[model samples]
Target chain A: MDPLEVEFLAEKETVKIIPNFSLDKIYLIGGDLGPFNPGLPVDVPVWLALNLKQRQKCRIVPPEWMEVEKLEEIPFSMGLTKLLLTHASDNIPKADEIRTLVKDIWDTRIAKLRLSADSFIREQEAHAKLDNLTLMEINTIRTFLLDSLNCMYKLRSNLQQGSSKGQFSNY
Target chain B: MSDALSDCGSDASHDGGQEDVMTPAELIEKLEEAWLNEKFSPELLSNRSEVVECVMEQLTHMEANLQRVKKGDAKASIHRMEIDRIRFVLSSYLRSRLQKIERFFPHVLEKEKSRGEGEPSLLSPEEFAFAKEYHANTETYLKAVALKRMPPNLQTVELLKAVPEPCLDSFVFLRVKEPQENILVEPETDDQREYVVDLEEGSQHLMRYRTISPLVSSGAVQLI
Candidate 1:
């Protein structure tokens, strides 16, 4: 299988189209497509829609997520993974602008998350000092702190190693 | 060969082809620029093959020049490494294009069939042939697997039933570009042909992805 196929399968997005011509039911290796009518809106795979658009047989409707206002309305709690999986489309004409917006949102949300997590852990630690913390609660916080610390350490070491390599490569 | 000599000698002539005679560093810079530009722009798809061909030609010339330099020279090794890096990028770039061709093989085949005989494929001939063979093999394998699993009584059933349908049930947001009436099948109301919603020129709404696809191709609203 081609790498792009794998990528598409992993991250599929549907495309909207308005056919300019009518057609009977067409069968494809993957599946069957519509008994299309001219001027009626139909949704199809992005690849198929692109092919039809290229042939001048259909008009493509831009996805709603492409709108800047809608994108801004996406809540921080949606998480980056969900946002990336659903919103990212190669066909988007303003992808760079969207990507920058996404990055900014992700950075802001992550900072907020980190702040909350830190305070929650600190509050738990304080409660534990007074013997108010449960064993399960202690374990959860312990795991979170360990994971975060390990990640930070790894990132720091990688940065240091990269700089050292750059300095020595000149020689 | 004489061709290779002429390819190299043309660089020294003061025609407008300064690129042909560029130094190793300059050549590497040019290659890097081309690669980055290709990476960033979707419009470069048609021109990619020629860009790659030019890079390969320059790389060949670079390798020939390196052969005359001392093996122990640091500059020679560095240039060789740069060539290797460029070569890797070129291969990956080609592979990405091939992937797109393969993914859209059915559409490509349909277009090709409609075109005149002896017309060129978007992909290189070798890649197109490979895609065709791969598709054929997959179909055969799927049929064989389906036959093996069928019950004796249903053995005569067509294999088409066993073929999985491409999943097309994802919802997407769409911005309405043109004002048009649509027959909406909302649960609250019966299928209504009356303009359910007046699609203002720049209004945005979350709708079934297929509903607005045609507008996108017609340069209605651009995907963000």
Candidate 2:
């Protein structure tokens, strides 16, 4: 998947936003969103929140995890942090600190991922645990990693005689 | 849009196995799952016409309602935005399928032809038609450009052998939705031995697509 598409998925995650105007409960296909009252916080998807912010109709309340200290426990995605920082940094407090902290977290996570990937390649493991790795992190190394795995598999398969062709399970 | 949609899809389902109603939200979830699975899987998955039809119905219904509302209503705009998001997903999902069909048309057609009398199809009706057309055009183009230049004995080309089949040994990242036991993990090389690992519910894993292809169609696991 493209990194942008991953960002698109992040936009669906709900965040608290304070609308500047009042509105009735809007029953949407996915779910209801509004009943927005002036100066009162309501939960909304980031896409809608960003749209409202662009119109100067609302103030985005960054998710709890966007804070510098709270970055460690974020349930949301790194792509989301970037999206919020890029689009609605004004609403988020200590934006620069959060940005730096987010970078730190991402760097640490990627570093750990590289370590694991190196070991995985060295050991020639069949499968690896995907615990706590964000989708984007996995995506970053997916192509290179899978290609290497396949190349190794092909080399091994050639060593064996009459290994059957891979079969796709029928639906 | 992110998850199960519980409020819509009261229409008759052609899938026939489950009489139980799938809510609109759940239908949406199903579509997204199918989308991602199709996107990541090396092979074309079975057609999900039920989800496609239901989602189309829901979109049509919501759109019909929007037509009655005034243009400037805040609710209408929000509804439009939601619809656009869903529409994007739906189209992306379909386009991915089309791309796969184009890539593996001969094998896909062969699979369809070789299936049993009552088995589920790999392609939807429209997709099947498109594949047939694509196959004819490709053959015509090949014959015109190169095949016709060959000796009569060598002119005949087998597309099934020519086109590379999807490699099921390719790895994928998946999340287990339903817990499963004794799922076999095949060895990658001669030195490593095959082993079975119990798939715990909600746990993610990186593994070969072939090992969990059945689990995917059964909705027991979702391809990330």
- Name model 1 segments beyond 4 Å from true: A1-171, B1-47, B116-120, B147-224
Question: What's the lDDT for residue A28 in model 2?
Answer: 74
Give the top-scoring candidate (lDDT). Answer: 2
TM-score of each: 0.33, 0.92
Candidate 1 lDDT over B18-106, as tens digits, reads 44544433433333433433232222122234345556676776678878988676345435644665676577666655654454445
Candidate 1 global lDDT: 0.46
Q: Please give, as one word, the docking class of candidate 1.
A: incorrect
- Candidate 2 local lDDT, residue B58: 82
- Across B134-178, the per-residue lDDT of candidate 2 in tens digits comes to 999999999999999999999998888887788888888999888
Candidate 2, which CAPRI tier?
A: acceptable
Model 2, position B30, has a per-residue lDDT of 74
Query: Clashing pairs in model 2?
Result: B4-B25, B5-B24, B5-B25, B5-B26, B6-B25
